[model samples]
Target: MNEGKLPEWLHCNKCNAFINSLSNDSRLYILECTHIVCKKCAFARQRQSGNVLCPVCGTTCAAKCIGGDELPHDVQLFMDQSMVLSELDRLRYCVQVTLLAQLR
Candidate 1:
């Protein structure tokens, strides 16, 4: 972990706001499509459009707000990574099951 600093690329996929530049209490959400979004843009999109969709992939598949804005940037980064890995695992399992079924 960078401790006092986060990578430059660590940002909301939509607004491109650097995580470190965000306020200490800035909310973030992890989209099911595995995109990270800041709460401002997310909620604004929701209010304007009636739902928060991934701007990058335009997926309303799902989104998760793991916790409030009080969480530290490092913690938020960890959660984002964990969510992505979990999604990948689920997808891999689905592909495996599909391939096995097709062989039968």
Candidate 2:
């Protein structure tokens, strides 16, 4: 993920609440329209307006739209940190190899 991008994505698009900031029982839903919402708001919208629409793009979702394991905040954070660490390790290795090649 780009710098600060994962942080941006880990928030409910509707309420703008941080994913981790939500209650432990709260579930996160990712919309096909590339939006995300907390289960509370999702159910509320469905109960009130009788449809599951993307709060961001206003796109309609299928009847069972909230069942994806996609990019949970914890997993996304792990992945992002792993990527940065891997790149740093690679650069460190290159520097070591270059030093060894220089014979000094």
Candidate 3:
């Protein structure tokens, strides 16, 4: 795989980091809020308090799991779509800023 291309399933929504999803010793956690997070970030949040909130939605009911397979299909699809839209919006903002700078 290219160094700059991350597997879709390995994208962590919390820290925006690419993680190894296939490692047996990997410590990735999937939240009930449909957010994927690295173990280090999850633990850090928990250490700051007794419960860990979903970094994406600020929900306090997230459960730690290895994957998001248990989520309902509709929920999963919605999450994926939201992530894509978020990325597109960010790219659009960057492009707009670049164009404005050139015109100034």
Candidate 4:
């Protein structure tokens, strides 16, 4: 996981959902454990403060809302906002990949 390189976005093993990569904006703030999740699943388990749990892996996280613990200034931020993916898109994308390999 080199910083500034493409983020390693992963699908959650538990719910079969794509996890989002953390963004610099998010890293600069106090949001914990950058992970992507489906909006529907995230909404269902949203915390009172509006934080969300990882839809796939069950990692607890805050929604777009920010506030929790801050990272140190010297630490280079590795998270990026660009890597988040919707559930349907993720599923569809995976299917396309599978289908393509089958054709080959």
Q: Who wins the TM-score comparison?
A: 2
Q: Model 2, range 14-84, lDDT digits (tens) per residue?
A: 88876543333565666656677777666555534456766677777732223234334443432456687
lDDT ranking, high to low: 1, 3, 2, 4
Residue 87, model 1: Cα distance from true site in angstroms: 22
**What value does the lDDT take at residue 59 in candidate 2?**
78
* Tens digits of per-residue lDDT for model 1, 29-96: 77778888877766655635455767778766455653434444435456446566887899999999
Instruction: Judge candidate 2 at residue 86 and give its lDDT.
Output: 88
Residue range 1-104, candidate 4, lDDT tens digits: 33323234443333544434335432212225554333444466777766766655566776542211343221223334433335457889999999999999
Which residue runs of candidate 2 sit more than 4 Å off their true CA positions? 1-9, 21-24, 47-51, 63-78, 83-104
Residue 85 lDDT in candidate 1: 86
Question: Which residue segments of model 4 deviate by more than 4 Å?
Answer: 1-31, 65-104
TM-score of 3: 0.44
Candidate 4 is scored at a TM of 0.30
lDDT of each: 0.64, 0.59, 0.59, 0.46
> Model 3: runs farther than 4 Å from truth?
1-8, 21-25, 47-50, 67-104
Clashes of 4: 7
Error of 4 at 49 (Å): 1.3
Q: What is the Å distance of residue 9 in model 4 from its true position?
A: 9.0
Report the Cα lDDT for residue 63, model 4: 50
